[model samples]
Target: MLLLLIGFGSDSNKGNKSTKLTVNETFVTNDKGVATISGKTSPDYGVNIDNAKQTAADSDGKFSFEYNLKGNSKKSLRLEVSKDYDDNTKKSKLIYVKPSKKFLANRESLAQESSRAAVASKSQRKAASESSESQKKAESEKAKVESEQASDITRLSEKPTDEQSAILTQLANQTFSKKYPYKGSKIHTILGNIQPWTKDGNVWFAKYEATIANAFNAKRDATLEIRITPLSRDSGNVSFEDY
Candidate 1:
C-alpha cells in the first residue's frame, strides 16, 4: 500500500542520460512457484532478470513481469534494467524466497496450537462456573437451617394457648387442694375457662378460680395462682399457691 516515484532530468549537452529503476515490491510468492517482479523505470528501457528479457517500460515509465522459480530452498532473484548493456545498467535488490512446503507446515502448526489453547481456556471457565454454583447451593442450605432454628427458639419464648389448657387446669386444682385443706370441706367443681398465662424470662404464671363445698353442702369460690418452668419442648415443672 505504499507508493514511491523518482524522476530524472535530461541534459541536451550530455549524449544519453542514465536510466534509473525502482521496485514496487520487495518479495512475492504463489502456489505455482511463480514470482512477480514489478517496478518503474525511465522511458524506453528494457527490463530483465538474470539476462532474461521481459516487458519494456510503458508511457508512464512503468513495467511488470513474472519469473518461475526453480528451487526447493531459499534463493535470490536479481533484476537488471538497461538500454544497451555496457555501463548504463541498473540492478534491483535481491529478493529471498522460502520453500513452499516449509512455509505451509509452519502455518498449520501455529493454527493447531491456537485451537488447543482456545479449548483449554473454555474448559477452565466451565469448571469455575460449576464450582461457584456448588458453593452457592451449600450456603443456601446453611442459611435455611439457621432460620428454622431461630423460629423454634422464638416459639419457645412466647406464651402458650389452647395447647396448654390441660396443664393450666390441673395446676389450678392442685393449688386449691394445698391451701384450703379444711377437713370438712371437699372438692366440688373446677371452672372450665381459665385466665391466660404470662411469661417473664423462662417462667410462666397463671391465675384461675375454682369452687369448694363444705360438709354441710355449701359451695364457695376460691382464687389460685400457679407458676411453671419448662425444661424442654415437652416437659416442665409446676408449683401452686392460693390467694
Candidate 2:
C-alpha cells in the first residue's frame, strides 16, 4: 500500500535545511513479462498479468511484484526511482536483470515460444475453415442458380401484373426474385449453384425484382435477405427483409 507521512518542524532564517529520503525498493512486474517496479518509477516496470494497474505498496515503501512486458515473464526489466517526481540528479541507473545473449543460450526456455505460436495456429485454422465453408457455399449456390434459370424461363416476369397493381398498392406486396448479378455471384459462391442459359434471359428479370422493390423504397444500394430457422427442415419462403 502507498503510505504517506508529514513531519512538522520549525524553520529558522539563519539555519540550514536538510532533507533525507531513503527509498525502500520493491518490485512489481507487469504482465508483459518485463521487470518489476517499486513505484511508477522510470525506466520500465510491469506486472505478471497483462495490465498496468497500481497495486498498493507494502509498509516501508517496500513492495514485490512480477513483471510483464508481454504475457511471458522470462525477460529482463529495468526500473528507475528518484526522490521527487522530476529529480534528474536523483535518477537511478539502469538495473539489468539478464541480457538477451544469456536467455537465448538456453534452448529449453526458447522452446516455450510455442505459446505464442499456438495463437497464430488458431487464427490460421479459423481462416482455413471459413475459406472452406465459403467454397462449399459457392458451389451450392451455382447449382441452385442453374436450376432456378430452367424454372424461371416458364415463370412470369417480375413486372407487377394488372391484378398485382391493386394488391401491390393495398398490401404493399412488391414482388422480389432471387436473382441479380452480384446476388447470383454471391449465391453461386456461397451455395455452389449454377444457372443454365435458358434462365439467363430471365436472370436479369429476377435480379430486377429485388432491385425494383428496393428502388420503390428509394434505396440506392441493393440488399440481400437471409433466413435463420433453428429447427425447421424444409426451406421456407424467405422474404427479402428476412435478413
Candidate 3:
C-alpha cells in the first residue's frame, strides 16, 4: 500500500507540471498599434489577460490575444490560465511591450509623403486656374479685334473714299490687261459708277462698266465684277471676274 501511494503522488506532480502556463516576456506593437500576447497552456484551458474576458486555448495548447496600445509607446500585460480539472490557477510574469521603431519610422515617412502630395496638388490646381484665365483673356482680345475689323470692312464697302476708288481702278486695269493680252487690245474709260455687293461680311464684290477694243479694232462695252478681300486695316486683295 505504501509503494502504490508513492507512485500516485509522483503522477500528481507530473500532472501539475504539464498544466503550467508559459508566456513571452516581451512583445512589440506593430504598425497598427496592436500588441499580440501568446502563450502555451493546457488544452481547452481558460486564459485571461489583464483581468479581461477569458479565452480558451486551442487543442494544441496554444493561445494568443491582441491588446491595443491606444497610441501609447509602452504597455504592461499580465496573464492567468486555469483548467477545469486543475484546482490550482497558473499566472505568468509581467510582460512588457513597446511600439516597434520600424513602425514609427514608416508612419512618419508616409505622413511626410502625404503632406508633400497635398502641396503638389494645390500648386497644380492654382497653375491650372491661372492658365485658364490667361487663355480667356487672350480669347477676349482676339474677339474684340475681329469685331473691329468687321466694322471697318462694312464701312469701307458702304462708301469708298477717293484714294480707295483710285486703287480699285488701277487694280481693275491690271486684271483686264492680264486677261486680254492681245498686242493691240486697249481699254477706254473704266466705269465711274461702282455698285458693291457682298455675300459674307468679310468680302465685297463690285461691278463696273467699260469700253474695250480688241486686236481687230472692234469695240464693245464690257462689264466686270471685282472681288475685294481686306487683308488688314490698310491693305486688300483684289480679284476679277467677267460679268
> What is the C-alpha local distance difference test score of each model?
0.60, 0.35, 0.67
lDDT of model number 3: 0.67
**Alpha-carbon runs more than 4 Å astray in model 2:** 1-61, 71-78, 86-89, 97-243
TM-score of each: 0.32, 0.23, 0.41
Q: Model 3: runs farther than 4 Å from truth?
A: 1-26, 30-34, 45-56, 65-97, 153-243
Scored against the true structure, residue 190 in model 2 reaches a CA lDDT of: 23
lDDT of 2: 0.35
TM-score of 1: 0.32
Per-residue alpha-carbon lDDT of candidate 3 for residues 24-141, written as tens digits (9 for 90 to 100): 7789988876778888887888876666655789998899888777554677666667775344655445677788887777678888999999999999999999999999999999
User: What is the lDDT for 146 in model 2?
Assistant: 63
Collision pairs in model 3: none
* Model 1 stretches with alpha carbons more than 4 Å out: 1-99, 154-243
- Write down the worst ten-residue block by lDDT for model 3: 6-15
